[model samples]
Target: MVVALVGNPNTGKSTLFNALCGARARTGNFPGVTVEKKVGRLKLPTLGPSRSGGGGAAEVIDLPGTYSLSPRSADEMVSVDVLLGDAYGTPRPDAVVCVVDASNLHRNLYLVSQVLELGLPVVVALNMGDVARARGTTIDAGVLSEKLGVPVIPTEAHRRRGLEELKTAIVAAASGPALQPVRSLPDAVVAEANALEGWLSEHGCPDVPAYLRERMVLDVGGQVVERYRTRCTGDLPAHLGEVRSRLAEAGCRVPAVEAAGRYAWAREVLDGAVETTPEPAATGSDRLDRILTHRVWGLLAFAALMFAVFQAIFSWAGPFMDAIGEGQGWLSGLVQSAMPPGAFRSLIIDGVIAGVGGVLVFLPQIVILFLAIAILEDCGYMARAAFLMDRLMSRLGLSGKSFVPLMSSFACAVPGVMATRVIENRRDRMVTILVAPLMSCSARLPVYLLLIGAFVPATAYLGGWVTLQGLVLFAMTSLGAVVAIPVAWLLRKTWFKGETPPFVMELPPYRWPSPRNVALRVYDRGKAFVTRAGTLIFAASVLIWAAGYFPGDHTELHAVQAKMENPQVAADMSAEAWDALEERRRKLSADLIADSALGRTGRFIEPAVKPLGWDWKIGVGALASFPAREVIIATLGTIYSLGGDVDETDDGLRDAMRRSEWPDGDPVYTLPVALSVMVFFALCAQCAATLMVIKRETNSWRWPIFTFVYMTGLAYVAALLTYQIGSRLF
Candidate 1:
């Protein structure tokens, strides 16, 4: 059975899901939307065992967190659909555990009242019970249970509180009546809507709310017509349009009047059962937000905090990253020396070792990246960061919530795009997804690192505090964000027009995040990264190796260069060794690649990029790295002098690049060429994983194609512009 867990954003529903299901949770983007869905399964904990016992586990789908069923965003619509079965194929949940924030009972009860109207069996789990008790609030659970008609059990899931009561409630209600409509409808509006619905019955408006038909007509200027004859539920009455015309002819706006009798009932139900310490001037969330959410200091703190995260990634992860890189290089060498110089050997050393290993070098950053992000999310500061950035983002057709996904894109677009699930609005989520690629993803980092290491002088700047290299990298990131804003605004105006999603969110009281919970999220995300690299990067690596390995050319020009640059000087050399040496020399020539399929293709494309200063070899590297961006660095590392002196710091591949020449002895990696390459990667949509994610998010081939075409076109034009502009300036 598919069970969906739903509650307000900060109400600990997610934490409870993790606690119940452990690592079985699947985190992925919602079908046709960038918003993520996390679903998992676990055996009913307190149940003795299934009576029919075949190990059929009860599955729980942790739907995107939502406040109420008002359905402002598509994200929240998922919750409503799951709850009311209003949306197609979303089964009315077998039972809903309404998780109410114990401390904020009134607001929490609003959702409960609306949910109760859906006529589903619901067990109210009053969450954060511990917090309420500590704050001197008293909850009469028995009386509250009596008042709601349905069972009301208090729970502090984070601490495993009230599990027994909640379990018993669920177990008992599994086959019982789940929901009952309680809110008495407005007599006149309900009667009018029912008459209209009866007349419009031929269309697909079956079971649609009465008031919705009027609002739909006013907003869309269309009747409730079936989208397709195949989908028509029944025959329509003749006067369906007449009913809408009459409402229009009345020409007076009518605001919805609430059924206060139900509110009065819910209020009377809770009045005797719930009580909080009368307004302590400032309490947990308010006290904490005063500082952490302060307008200026919060912004300052956020900047400093992000700066520290980046500092840690670059500085602290260096030794580990270097170790991985060196180890990979060493393994490649060992394989090359041991194998009998053939396709298998080349595949292992060049394709697998060089390609996959190059991508893995950034693993340290990946782990640290997600770990820090998860920490911020756990501590609940990520939400605050969004709240702070909302004002600035609103101008660009985004919310402060856009900051989290965009910031997350720094590590990888897959997860960042997936994180958009947290944004409630469909339009907001799509905008986040469309523009997230512009956020300087980690795949682009390798390209940036390569360029900056080669071109930008690393030295004291700002009198010594900021290094030039660091500043340039930071500036580029800022530039990407600046460019993304206008693009987002344009998208909103053109294709994704919808109301801006509401930004109001509850800030949970700050508490030290649990290490156990943090570790689980980090593990899930890290494992996902590893699995992706092992497949995508590993395959790309072999492709890259093959590009540079085959079609040996025994040319005197490249043989001499190889001997001069990478001469094998073994004293125990024999005739066999000499033969091997000759083969290796032939393999190292530039034209050797041209003879191979990959090399020949690069040669064919060389003319297209020759104006940008890249030779056939560079073209080969570029072609090979298409499937995986970072492997371009590793591809170059292996392609250039067999991974020797590939420091990428001072004198980064620069010496070898400078030594390279065309027929006219022109220098490679000139200022114009480097800028061209940087600009190319800056706009290029070149990641197998990212493309897969886009396909998954849009659920169609059309959108990813659009993304690729526009981004590639943009990359070409941008690079061309940069090279031309720089040639004149430099």
Candidate 2:
């Protein structure tokens, strides 16, 4: 049986899902970690075979956190359709768990009431009840259960409290009845809901009542009206008939009026069950909202927070990163000493460790980045970040939800693209998808750091506290995001013209994030990263190694071996110069890579790209980074006198790039080229793997093709502009 865990974005639904399933959880960060859907399996330790339902092995899918049933965005609509059993390939949930932030019951119940209309069995886990009581809010759990006609369990999922009780509730709902009795709205409200159903008849069989009562009320909770309409190919005929009837009766679509009634009915049901005493007429959220939502300070705080994230990536990961480097270096030496000098030894040292280790070295940065993101996200500041940008976003005709996804694009476009699922309007989702790739992703990190660390002087810019290099990094990312804003605005006025979805979202109360919860997240995301290192990364490394390996016989250091095997060279060199000879061997090893197939391919692309000012080496670097962008550094280092440098990854490449040259007596890769490269990456569709995944998620080649073509075109134009303009000025 499929048990769906549905709740508002931060209501601890994921934590609870983890608790129930333990390690059985499957994580994809799908559509790229932004529209992450976690599906986990659970087996009851001991179940009465005769009595257990669905054969006792259960799979629970933790859908994207959605606040309501309205299909406002693609992902949000996924929740609605899944609950309605209308989302293609998704089974109707045998039972659903509606997780609510008990402390924020008033708003939480707003979703709860919506779910009740779905006519399905549900159990409400009054999550964060511990926080609720601590905040002097008393929740009458038994009363709420009786009023809503469902099981209620108080849980602190992060602390693992009340989990058993929650499971019991879930099982009871599953085994007792296939469908639970729905809480009927007041006669007038029900009549109005029916009237909505009548009005929506032109919309189809899965009418407004089914969506309102099933997913919104009984399953997911919260009345989120998604503006993007979805009707299956098979259902379009019904929709056509429905739309015909609706147009036949004009002035009948009353989304505003129906919304008021839903809220009114919700208020009545929750009136006395949950009590919140006013706090001397001022709340902490309110007080903080004053400054945090202020037009000026809010922006400054955002700036400061963003600075911290980048600071952690470049600065905080240094010592540990260095340590990791030294350890990998030592390991390589040991392997070389132990293994006989042959292709096997080189494969282990250069191909496997160098390539794999190159990618692994960046794990620390990923961890640091996601940790900071989680902290800001959990602390509720992220919502405020969205709030602060509301005015600016509205001018661009965007919902506030569009902001974080765009921000996340800096780390990776895949996640950023997926995150746009939170936006309910198809046009908004589409436009956001189109612009997300423009943000400088984490793949651009290695390239940016390589250049910025070398060329930009590390002296204080405004003061000694801020290095010019750090400021430069921040400015590049900020500029990338800034460029996307005008692009989004332009798209709205042009090809994406339709009503942008209305932005109506509840801001949950701010609480100190649970460390236990944060710990779980750190571990979960870390585990996911490790798995990638082993799987996709492992495969990509092998493929790249093969590309660099073939077309040469006796691949045992072809350049180094040729010299050593030469009798004249052997006679000239004495035992005293063996160490020098070995160093020469390393340089020779590096030279062979330049002549290899991978190297030749770089030369092939260089001519085409040279007008954009990149050399053959840059072409090789770009080629190696298809799987992931950070691998470019390793590839570049390997191409320039650092044999097997992809494995023996080093920061020296940045310095190397500084001293490298072109044939014309000019610097091959100067500061402007570096900046242009950064801009190109910020706008370009560089990650082939991300493009492939986008194809899988959208289930069409069309969107991915559009994404790749438009983004690459934009990247080229932007790079051309920057270079042509910057060259004249500088």
Candidate 3:
């Protein structure tokens, strides 16, 4: 049997799903996160053996969280299609489990009533019953069940209460006959729906349900009709208009009439079933919202929160990163000791270990960033943050809904682009998707930390509360974020010119962040990061190792090493003589890299990157990082590792870079050059995965191509300006 889980946004539906499915569930984007679906096997203890001689596990699908089945946007339409079995690759669920928030029973029941009309066996799971009881709200579940003509099981999904009963209810409902809706639409509306259903059947649009036809006629401008006409032939639009006109004359106007009638029915259901007890002057959410949702205070709070988050990301992850670096060094030493001295040994120690390890060390910071985001989202502050940002976002032709996706980009742009599905307007969604990569994702963190540590002094500034380096890092990310504003505005004024939709969102009452959910999110994000490292970054690392390792002789380097290791010469020579020999060996290694395939490629692009204060070495790193931005750290590590014959430690790379010089013997990587490189990476679309996601989201290669071109141009100009001005001033 197949069961569908549906609910309003912020209801404890997901928690319930997780409780039932545990680690058995799998999450995937049907199209994107806003409409992502999760499917899992729900095993029932009471069911024992199946009647069909199969296991007793039922297939449970968690559909996207939606307010109603009304087709307003594509995302919401997905929910309706899946419920109605109209979506391709999804069959009609054997039963429907409608989870509703008990505290907000009247409004929650509005969606339940709509599901009831779907002619499916639905068992309403009254979630947050504990929260409701605590807030002096009492819900008579038995009364509600009787009134709605379905099973109602009060459940506290977080506490795992009533889950067994809920599961039993679902199994029983699935085994029994499907329940029909008790409430009926007005006669005129039903007549119009019947007529449209007949018309749809005649027009070769067979299997169109009555509820769907009613929705098509009601939501004339919605995705339902837009998707339907593409299937049926002849004058569908004209016929729809005539049906709508007839309905309006019968006192039914598109969305307004549908909404009013459904809400009226919901209120009638809740009138006797729910009761409230008077208590405190204000609920905790109300008091907190005063400060959290304030125009002035909320904005300040958001900035302070982000500042703290960034600071923690930099400072808190330091020790773990250092430990990781040391571990990599230890592992590399073992590998070097085990293998013969040749290109193969170098591949394992330098190419595989150094390159992959460079990206792995930053995993701590990535985990912390995701943890913070998860906390904010769980505790409900994220919604308030979006609300506060909506005013500013509006001026840039974006809705508050766009704020979540843009903010999500700070962690990574792939998920950030997917998050844009929440934005209802196509123009706003596209613009947000294009500019999201500018938010300085965690992939850029490795580069920022490497460059900042190398050049910027870690002194305190602004009365000593903030370190100058931290402030600079914050400022660099802030600059990247600021670039999105103008870019979005320009794009809207030109290609995507349209009215920005008004922002509307529910602010779920703040609750303690669930440890399980936060842990799961952090784990999922960390897994994704590691998976990319092992796959994409790993392949790139090997390719780069091959390019830098082969087509060159190591005979001169081995000769210098042998001479330095000779006991007769070492015992007879002074310490300075030994040091000179080692330096010569290092020079030989550097010379070898300079003549390698990678070096030649870097030199080939030198002229193009020179204006940004970069030489061929930096050019090589930049080019290697085009596949993945964070790979630049590993690439630079590889470059400097070969240059100084040192392991890829932050200190080692920094010292090597400090001692590097141009052909004229002038210092190559000055403060201005470091800052220029940082600015360029911050603004550039360096991650191919992000570009691919944009293509997928927009369903066009054109937008992704345009994104790459514009962002690259912006990065180049920004870096050039920063370099020229800073070089002259400092």
Candidate 4:
């Protein structure tokens, strides 16, 4: 049997899901939509045998948190389809578990009313019961159950309270008969809905549910009406308009009438079932919000909080990163000793290990970043952050809802783009997705750190409060965000022109973040990073290694390398002769690389990148890193003849970059060149993963293509300007 869980945002629905499924949950995108689908095996211990004649487990699908059943877009429509068992690859849910915030019963019941109309058996999980009691509110679950004609189980998902009862209720409700549709609307509206449903059956569109027909009549320009309009021909639109006009004349409007009717029914059912004492002058959350959400102080607090989080991400991950680097080096050494010194050795040591290890070193930073974000989100600070950003975002014709996604882009763009699903406005969501990649992600962190550490002087200022390197790092990180401002504005004005809607978000009462939830989120993000490194970065590394290794004879170079490795030959020669042999080996290695296919490609693009103060090697690294931005570190390590084990902090790779020279013997990398490179990567859409996610989220190649073209052009121009101006000034 299959069951669905639906709730409004901040109702602890996710926490409840975690409590119900725990490690059994797996996440994937719903078919044909970017909205995340979380399904888990729910063990029903109460029922000995499966109600559906299967195992004693039910598959629970966690639908997205929404305020109501009304769908404005295709993504929103997924929920309704799933409930109706119309979604492809999904069975009709045996029952639905509607989770509601006990503290806010009136508003929560609006969605509850809609679920009741689905004609499916539902078990109400009234969550956050503790919060309700803290406010001196008491809810009689027995009365509520009797009034709604369903089981009502009070739950505190975070504390694991009432979970057993909730599970038992789910089993009982799934076996029971479906609830009759709620007659919340007036008879006039009901008559019109019934007539419309019969008319639809007479037309080509048959089997339309009574609930959907009522929604079509009530939601005048909603998705249901638009959907049936296409299926049935002949003045359907005019008929809908007439139906809505008649409803309005009968003292019921199309959309507003639905809300009024449903809310009234909710009040009638909730009467005497809930009791509350007079509210205090100011609750703890209210007092906290006074300071936390203040216009001026709130901004400062937010900035300070973000600074702390970023600082932790950079500093706390150092030891773990060093450990990973050391481990990688040890493994490379072991491989070099065990394997014969040939093509396979090079592939293993220089290609696979180096490629994947280089990116994996940043796993700590990724973990710390995700951990901080998850904690902030769970603790309810992220909502306040969005509220604080709304005023600023409105000037760009976007709401504060766009801020959370953009903020998430700092750690990675793929999830940030996915986060855009929370935004209901199509224009705001699209604009946010297009500009999200412009926020420098963790992938660019390696590039920035490498460039800044290698080239920028370590000069301290403000009594060591800030150093030149730190300043450069901060600038590089902030560069993309600053650039995103105008890009977002331009997108709003040109393609996604629309007025910024007033942003409204619930600020859940502040509480300690759940450790289990935080750990699960961090684990998911870290695993995703590791998987990408093992797959995409690994493949790119091998391809680059081949391109740089072959298409030219390496026989002579290998012979020289072999001779250099022979200790007997080294002892046979004098110091000067030994030095000369080493020099010859280095020259052979360089010459072989210069003539290789990768070298040719780099040289071909050298002219294009020269304007940005980059040499052919730098061009090669940039080109190789297009598939994954962090691959540039491994590419450079390979290009400089340092094995892939070198990281941004590796003295060898940094020294190689510093010593690099052009044909005329001038230094290839300088302060200006470093700045130019950092800026280019800062603004570039270098990750193919992010672009693919954009395509998936937008459900179109055109947007991703447009994103790539626009961002790449922007990066090129920005780099060109930085180099040209810095060359003269510095």
Candidate 1 residue-wise lDDT at 533? 35
lDDT of 2 by residue, 206-303 (tens): 44444453222212112233221343223433433454345335432334434555677667767778787777355677788878777888789887
lDDT of 1 by residue, 1-730 (tens): 4456777777778777777787888776555544456768766544433222322356677777766565545566566656756545445566677888887787777677767777767788888887777677889988887778888888877776777677677655554544556553344434556676654565554666643443333222222232212345543333445544564455422222333433555677778897877765465767778877899888988888877876676677788978997899789778755655556765787677766675576567667766787787777787888888999889888898887778767656666765665676667877888777777775677677778777767789678899977876786656556778788999999899866756887777766686767777878766656664346555655665665666564345333433433435544567787666654654464345556777788779988777666787777777766776665664565456435234344353666666777788777777777778877777777765565456656556676677778777777777778788887888
Give the Å shift of residue 106 in candidate 3.
1.4
Model 1: what TM-score? Answer: 0.82
Per-residue lDDT of 1-730 in model 4, one digit per residue for the tens? 8989999889999888988888788776687665668898888865644446644688999998888888755655788999988999999898899999999999999999888888888999999998898888899999999999999999999898999898888878777667787777788877887898767877788888777777787775677878888889556778888888887787887788888888899999999899988764457888899999999898899889977876676578788988997898899889876765778887898788877775676577768777877898789888898899888899888988788678767867766776676576778989999999999887898898888888999999999998999988888889999999899899888987656756878999888899998887777667755663346555656777788788777677667667766778877879898777766665666666667887789999899999999999898888777767877887787667775546889998999999999989999999999999999899988876677667656656798889889998999999999999999999
Best by lDDT: 4
- Candidate 3 Cα deviation (angstroms), residue 671: 8.9
The alpha-carbon deviation from the true structure for residue 424 of candidate 2, after best TM-score superposition, in angstroms, is 7.6
TM-score of 3: 0.83
Model 4 off-target regions past 4 Å? Answer: 46-51, 73-75, 198-205, 225-239, 404-430, 441-477, 493-499, 528-534, 563-581, 610-615, 627-678, 688-706, 721-730
The candidates, ranked best first by TM-score, are: 4, 3, 1, 2
Q: What global local distance difference test value does model 4 have? A: 0.82
lDDT at 399, model 4? 88
For model 1, the superposed segments whose C-alpha errors exceed 4 Å read 28-35, 45-57, 84-92, 204-266, 323-339, 352-363, 408-415, 441-478, 530-571, 574-589, 611-615, 628-630, 633-653, 662-669, 693-704
- Candidate 4 clashes between residue pairs 3 or more apart in a chain or in different chains: none
How does each model score on lDDT? Answer: 0.67, 0.67, 0.78, 0.82
